[model samples]
Target: MSDEPAGLVRPDRRRPEPLWHQAEMALRDLIDQGEWAPGLQIPNEDRLCEMLGISRITLRHALRNLEEAGMLRREHGRGTFVRSATMVAGVRGLTSFTDEMQTLAVSPGTRLLLAQVISATREIAEALEIAEGDSVVQLRRLRLGNGQPIGIQTTHLPSARVPGLFEAASDVTSLYRWLKDNAGIVPVKAKEVYRVGAVAAGDASDLELPVGTPAFEVERITFDQRSPFEFAVSTMRADRYEIRSTLYV
Candidate 1:
């Protein structure tokens, strides 16, 4: 009798599903059942192929599907490891990171990477509707969903509009919540631009993605009833994050 793990058992040839799909399902079950815990590297490709009784090409196809689905993460030089579920956010409306995660029933977390007062550059000034060289509070943060790093975001806000923000930086988890409570600022509308790009070398480590990996560069201008109050840029992991939209024709 074979004593191999059930989740790693070979797929039945008589089944209707393709071999690659069967391999994908079997691997997913292994991860989901905690037979392969998160952050634990799975068997090497050669061994996995032997256990699953699938060819190298077939196994590679299955692995790619799992990576795209966020069930596994593949490091350039290292082996693949089980990972947390992917996070999906709707771009149809303006929502805070905290709000997005909560809606998805995932715990949201933020780590402040940098916070200081800086002069707004021409680009930032234009987006915030402020004068160039004007004082703005610059905040760089690492955003997490379910304890996994997902994005690196930087925001610039007109310092004159929100007094004492610098002193209270340590307490901020949600910028939107802080703005609303401290300065009565609420976003009436926002315009966002998304560009497909590669992750920068410096930011790749923070986001747990390889340098040159696909990423989304998002720029947003947020307005209150009075004026544009914030300008933000985010580099989010393409594997861990997705933007969903509903369309009607």
Candidate 2:
């Protein structure tokens, strides 16, 4: 579950200690206890100041400390939000993009941005377990929902397996689902790693950000009965999305 902090408090003038520090401790407690879970947005600055009865500097000091500790993250002009240390439930389950969009009540669409075949570089070879100079199919697409560019997905499939997949999958909906329905490849288990980083220069323009704006990174490797079919890297806008995970005791 996501945490929504509504306990912004500006203290009365009669209080001996400052309100910001007090509010900071309260927020820290909230985070530690899973009250304000990671990737959830906290109240904005003005609301926080008014609720906590503290100056901007004091509130910022507490916030900066928490952010540095990896419990939170801040963005310019967007707002402050929780940063999950690990992938949540939604991210863990292996599912198609089509299914995810349906769950979120958004219309999913893809623009076939690029389709190319190139020799595998050392990095790609290592990741895909193919020899260097072996050809691979690289598909680049802009993933959209509700007519907004939410993310970019670049998938690399070994040419050995899917020689003509790039051309055949010209912006077709839901590669995973399509594969399962047509080619009889269904993923059983997949590994996904999440990281916080800036968008790359090449993708900056496509992502509609300055040269190096913050974004959510997901690098994943998926396997089907046939082979490791999907290795992709995704970047999402930090402001528009949040993280959720279930922790078992």
Candidate 3:
């Protein structure tokens, strides 16, 4: 996990902006700057209220925003603590966890949640530029920042390119990063489809989403010039999340 503080570029209590949201962003910046490292319990609500010059309700709103973003977790009596930063490196850039997280100034790291060899189904084979039933390496990841869950990414790659990827699946934080380091398959272009949906039961169960909440879904097909590299499915929390892109149209 490697990310610097998210500085408050915009004040929330401005003319049209919301105070609580602005305060939340400012606090997030403080946490990202290493002012509050992960696992280190945050100051009590009363202390936070004094520091931010906000009421308890306002402070709580900001805190709740962080909790939903998966950047902070609140335990019964333990208090709020830092969560890992997740990347939203949009279709505008060709990047991996290591690249994007570093840009955001966060310590981006990965933990392999699953690695397996499976016969490529029609959908996957089509996406990966391989024939049906071809061998594919399924790599699943739980991306962390400092130490909290920020995203869940799963990839399917042709085994030929990443031989025994399943065997290499120990904490490969960035598959694209892995590609550059291991195969030199630097991506130049990628096609992405963005959608919004509720966190599935299984996803919610794993990510600890608050019973019912929406998560953004990003499906991507990475390419290196003429060939496809892999197929990916990623789910990220909507709060504190966005795909900033430039549009010419």
List RMSD in Å for every model shown: 8.2, 11.5, 10.1
Please, what are the lDDT tens digits per residue for candidate 3 over residues 32-122? 6777776777778887766666788988998976775556778886777876454444444677766776666557768777889999999
Q: Residue by residue across 63-107, what tens digits does model 1's lDDT show?
A: 987875566788989988887667766545677889888876568
Q: In what order do the candidates fall by TM-score, top score first?
A: 1, 3, 2
Per-residue lDDT over 106-154 for candidate 2, one digit per residue giving the tens place of the 0 to 100 score = 5677887888988888877777777888888888888766566767888
TM-score of 2: 0.62
Q: Per-prediction TM-score, please?
A: 0.69, 0.62, 0.64
Candidates 1 and 3, the one with greater lDDT: 1
Better candidate number, 1 or 2, judged by lDDT: 1
Per-residue error at 69 for model 3, in Å? Answer: 14
Task: Tell me the spans in candidate 3 whose CA falls farther than 4 Å from its real position.
Answer: 1-91, 246-249
| Residue 204 accuracy (lDDT) in model 3 | 74
Which residue pairs show backbone clashes in model 1?
A: none
Residue 72 alpha-carbon offset, candidate 3, angstroms: 15
Estimate the TM-score for candidate 1.
0.69
Error of 1 at 65 (Å): 20
